[model samples]
Target: MATSKSKTSLREDLTCAICFELFKEPVMLGCMHHFCRRCIVSYWKSVRSPVTCPQCRQEFPNKCCFQTNYLVANLVEKVRASSSPASVKYLEKELNDCLESQCSMKDAYISMIRKDKDKMEKIKKTGAELQGRVHNDFQALHHFLQVEEEAMIEELKREQEEMLQGLERHLEALQVAIRDVEKNINILRQTAGSTDQSVLVELPKLNSRPISIDI
Candidate 1:
């Protein structure tokens, strides 16, 4: 018997069409193509409604096209686990690259969060300052209104007192005029009772002159 020639090729035995990464959850599509289930599912989610196979671009049934092949998935995991040190080193390099990229993403996320917090703090400070200004303005307006109201009340009191004094003066003058008229009527009544025609004649002249009281 002759020595066996190398028949298997590394390219055909271990490779993925898309992403070129070691398959994690390998799924066999109807078109005889292989891909990680999660990756293909994400690819299908980008499309509108109807789904299709990522490899051959062949249209698939709605919602139920993506299938999981546990056999292939287990085989890929076992092969990667049992790989040589050189193969593991290459995979480790890719994983380290991914870890570095994740570190950058983490930095970006942290920076964005810090910026958002700073913006929020600024907004809070501005709101507090504006509130203080509004409060001061309201207090000033209240003080002004209070002073004006007090002034108006004082003026009204003064005017009311003046009106009351004027009204009392008018009442006193009216009472004096009424008393004088009553006295004149009494004098006329007395003269009528007496048989004195002279006094009656003098009464007409007294009534024509203005009354004067010296008190």
Candidate 2:
């Protein structure tokens, strides 16, 4: 009798139900089934009605039934490793490569973060300087207004003093004219003591001359 060769089955654990390929951006459905995110998205776009499970035939009222299944994907890899050591070793090598790439990405991200911090500090300092300048401008404007107000008050006071002085001068002139009239009346009274009553009455009818001054 001829010895039979044992058949090695390929891994169906990482295979996606939707695309029958390795699950990239794998997402879980409400029916607990795994599918690639792009694959499920494409299926959703093609469907006329609400999305449902292809395996269990469970119908969902809406197409928003898919979600990320990171834990399940990790579990699937673990299960595959228990069955096949070669697949596990291959997956570990790929995982190491991914880690190395991520390490480089982290270094770039750290440098970018440092740059952002420096930029943020510069912005904060500039903002503070702007605030100080704004405050100084307001203070300067306030002082200017105060000075203008005081100047206006001084001008008003000067005008009032000038008006009062003019009124005093006018009053003094009126007083002098009244005194001269009284003196003339006294002189007429004395002159009338030796004159007749008819001449005294005629003295009041005489025109008085106005006094004038240069200053």
Candidate 3:
């Protein structure tokens, strides 16, 4: 069984130099380089008296030998019939051969795996950086809320204290007025029990007196 490397080398060797295509009616020059019949003939007509090999540039006094390459032609036929059983067996042999050689599919697969691992590492690093940034942002936001909450609490306390002071002052004033009114009521009640005309007249004046209270 031929190796994949051998098959590739054979394919390269069978390719025509002038047309750079599959050898169509292949012919060999004096330098042993192969080219398509029409392609080489056309190239020679365009060049000067001495025709040269396109690959090696070796000049020949006259036109080089135009020998037919039946081996390359037959190989081309086998490669073209890829769906045939014979071609399939040949490809299988080449694949087996490539397994024994270096720089095969195994090495390529390992290289591909290494590349994906490196990519994953980069992705993980990026994810960590993003998470760290998000965490720091949340912490900053939480601290800001805490500061604002403290300031709000302080303002509430100050407002409540001011309200309490206002209420206390009003209550104190009301208490003092209650004590003064009670003292005057006791004095009037004693004066009314007297058998005097002046006492009765003063009682009517006390009833007419206007009372006021602080809001």
lDDT of 1 by residue, 1-215 (tens): 12112212332444566667667677777776778777777777777856667667787777466578887777676666647698778877987999999999999999999999999999999999999999999999999999999999999999999988977777776677788778778877877788867655555423333434422
Scored by lDDT, the top model is 3
Tens digit per residue, CA lDDT, model 2, 63-151: 78878888766755555565577876786798899999999999999999999999999999999999999999999999999999999
After superposition on all CA atoms, how large is the RMSD of candidate 3? 16.0
Candidate 3 residue lDDT tens string, 1-215: 36657867777777777777678888777677888889988898998876788788888777656788887777777655763688789878987788657566778889999999999999999999999999999999999999999999999999999889988877887677677777778777777666775636444333232344433
Q: How do these models rank on TM-score, best leading?
A: 1, 3, 2
Measured with C-alpha atoms, the lDDT of residue 200 in candidate 3 is 63
What is the clash count of model 1? 0
Question: lDDT, candidate 3, residue 185?
Answer: 84
Please tell me which model should have the higher lDDT, number 2 or number 3: 3
User: Which segments of model 3 are wrong by more than 4 Å?
Assistant: 1-97, 100-104, 204-215
RMSD of each: 18.3, 18.7, 16.0
TM-scores for all candidates: the values are: 0.53, 0.46, 0.47
Model 2, CA-based lDDT: 0.76
